[model samples]
Target: MFLAWNEITRSKLRYALIISVMFLISYLVFFLTGLAYGLAQDNRTAVDKWQADGIVLSDESNTNINMSMIPLKSLDDVTAKEKAALGQTAAVIQLDKKGAEKVNASFFGINKDEFLMPDIVEGRAFDTDDETVVNNSLKEENGFKLGDTIKLAGNEKKLKIVGFTENAKFNVAPVLYVSINTFQEIRFEKVDTTENARINAVVVRAKEGAMKNVDLAGNDLKSYGIQTFINKLPGYNAQVLTFGFMIGFLIVIAAIVIGIFIYVLTMQKATIFGIMKAQGISGKYISISVIVQTFVLAVLGISLGLLGTVGTSFVLPTAVPFQSNWLFFLAIGGAMLVIAVLGALFSVRTIVKIDPLKAIG
Candidate 1:
């Protein structure tokens, strides 16, 4: 063990090269994992915040919330089932500010009275019909503040920014909250300059056991051209599964690369190992030394890789959609360590097979 450590310390250039390779590979794995997680969260953050048991869309539109429209009359029909209420009105609004870039923002029209608006960071929630809340991410990017008026969709309607909230993005765009009336106006436009269009979907919250039965009411909304309840929002499950697969592939690749590198390094030192065996040094000692060296390298590489990932995350813009959960980090770290140790063990077989007589010749 002492000799192995001394050899590593003396061959600074060689060890440094190996560590650098490990570092690069590990960093790539972590960065890919972070990016995959970030994208999945970005794709579903808005729907996840709804905390609704189910969503109702138009049958003709399939599961697409954007294309689905439910009349205001349907709200009562859905709420009659149980604890359900009209969820937030949602839309995609394109904003064009004078002398500034055109930005696409998610418009969520929530009943301010329902306490469904995202937690406020600055200012207050809407107090009037024309008031709206913008995400802090939007506020910072556009330099807007409370009481500021912003033009939407070719300056057709100017909406007031009443408040700023955190983590209220939808469909990868920052969210802005307004009254349902406003959202309807923005969405359908006034037909004949008087009547507003219907809403896109009715977000329903069900009473306990409502999901168990799988029927909202005796009306059979699905048969009536209204799409029945979807327990989870569309696109959510698929997005998560895709990201999980990507992260899993990256970790596996890292393990294989590290394992192969360590195994080859150990093989190269077979002659030296045999000489040590001839000097009465046990194979067990050589194997332990190799395993310890692998562990040290794995730890160093993963630690540095994590540091790099965190540093990169800090500079990443919120728009980039990067999320990091601690459990993922720990899981990846543990897996890397274990795989590296296994690779070291593969090389240890050569130590046991070393012929002491061959070393003297």
Candidate 2:
């Protein structure tokens, strides 16, 4: 350890450059990982909060909640620990009647009494058809406030912001919670009293031991567990896969880079290793020192990288979906360290083959 550290202190600029490379690479990996996690959570945060065991949708809807249309009477045929009817549609809402600023939002028509209704972080839940609760992001990012009236761009339906809920988003859009009746009027332009009145799907909380039985093929509906539904969210799988590959490749590249640098440094000090061996110093000692040096460099580089990432996250605006998960950072950092150690092992061969007489001459 002393030999490794002493050499580093002696050649401060050389080691600093190598450490800088690791730091930048690690920082990029960590930042991308945060983005990937944030985007995935944005797609399903509201649904995850439901803690529902399963969701029932028409098979004809191709597993899409927005496309599914099941008759309200179908709820009677379903059995579970608890079930709630859900209606969903996408909309662009204007902050004012003049249509100056607009935001994309998902409208979720739910009964205030149902488990699907999220607890309000501020204000109160909607009590009337004209009142709606929105995700707290609206207040932070769009300057929405309690009692602000929101105007639906195309249908001219105006909704009052009654409350704000945290972590309520779907498909990267904020969710608007309104009564089922209001949703029907917005979706169909008129409420129907016929026997065929329909809703998007039924969300269920099944008994602990009955998840496997949640599917209802006989009732012409299909069931999906909360995780399965999340995986099926539009573009969710694709985004996750893309980020996974990128992160994986970056780690591999980091390993190779560390290996090359350490190997080059070891080759430069070959004559020094030979002279030490000629003086009766063991090859194992020199080999161990090389590994120790690599370890020290890796730790310093990764630590600085993580610090940079944290600093960047703090300055980022709320509008940017950046979430910090220490667990992920630690895992990635640990992987980089391990691979760096393994990378240093390649230099052991050079140390082992050093001939004392040739190096001294």
The best candidate by TM-score is 2
Q: Tens digits of per-residue lDDT for model 1 on 1-361?
A: 5766787899888777777877887788788778777776665565556665566556675566666666655555554233222323344343434576566777776566653556778988888756788878776676677887777654376678888887766656777777777776666554222332465665555556254433444342432122232213456567767867876776677667767777787777777877888888999988888888888878888888888888999998756767887788888888877877786787788778878778556
Cα TM-score per model: 0.84, 0.97
Best lDDT goes to which candidate?
2
User: lDDT of each prediction vs. the true structure?
Assistant: 0.67, 0.90
Model 1: residues >4 Å from true position, as ranges? 1-6, 79-97, 191-197, 207-210, 213-215, 218-243
Per-candidate clash tally: 0, 0
lDDT of 2 by residue, 206-281 (tens): 9883667664646578888878888888999999999989998998899889889999999998889999999999
User: Per-residue lDDT for 274 in model 1?
Assistant: 77
